[model samples]
Target: MKFGARNQITATVGTVKTGDVMSQIDLQVDHPHGMSSVMTTESLQELGIKPGDKVRVIVKAIHVLVAKE
Candidate 1:
C-alpha cells in the first residue's frame, strides 16, 4: 500500500488499548518522547497489532497512523 504521508519511522508497539469503537496504540520510537495512534477497532484488528510488534508510524498533519507491514 502507498501513503501520502512522508514522515515515517520504525517503532515498537508499546501498548494496545481497544474499546468498542476505537483503539489507541502507543509506540516506542528512537526519540525519547513516545507517540500514539488512534484508529478504529476494526482497523486495529485488520492490522493484528499487539504489544512488542514492530510497526511503521506515519505522521501527516496532526494525525498519526500505524502500519504493521
Candidate 2:
C-alpha cells in the first residue's frame, strides 16, 4: 500500500472501543507517548480489528490512521 504519510509505526492493538457510529482504537507503540485512532464502526468491522492484532499506524498532520494488513 502506498501512503503519503511518512511517519509510520508498527504497533500492537491494545483496545477497541466501539460506539453506535464510531470506534476508537488504542495501540501499544514503541514511542514514549500513547497513540490511538478513531473511525466509523463500519470501517472497524471491515478491518476486523481486535486486541493483540498488529497494525500499521499512519500519522499525518491532523489524523492518525490504523491499517491492518
Candidate 3:
C-alpha cells in the first residue's frame, strides 16, 4: 500500500483493548519507546490485529507540539 506519510515504524503488537466503538492498540517498537494508536473497532477487526502480530505504524499530521518544563 502507498501512503503520503513519511513517518512509519515497524512494531509488534503489545496489547489490544477493544471498546464498543473504538480500539486501542499498543505497539512495542524497535526503539526503547512504544507507540499507541486508536482506531475504530471495524478497522481493527478488518486488520485482525492481535498480540504478537507485527504491524506498521504510520503517522501523518499537520503539526506536532513540544513543551518543556
Q: Which candidate comes out best when scored by TM-score?
A: 3
lDDT score at residue 68, model 3, on the 0-100 scale: 100
Whole-model lDDT values for every prediction:
0.91, 0.89, 0.90
- Residue-level lDDT of model 1, residues 1-69, one tens digit each, is 667886888999998999999999999999899999999999999999999999988777556455796
lDDT of candidate 3 over 2-47, digit per residue (tens): 8888688789999999999999999999888988999999999999
| Runs off by more than 4 Å, candidate 3 | 61-63
Error of 1 at 38 (Å): 0.2
Per-residue error for 1 in candidate 3, Å, reads 3.4
Q: What is the lDDT of residue 2 in candidate 3?
A: 80
Q: Model 1 TM-score?
A: 0.80
- Give the range where candidate 1 is weakest over 10 consecutive residues by summed lDDT: 58-67
Clashing pairs in 1: none
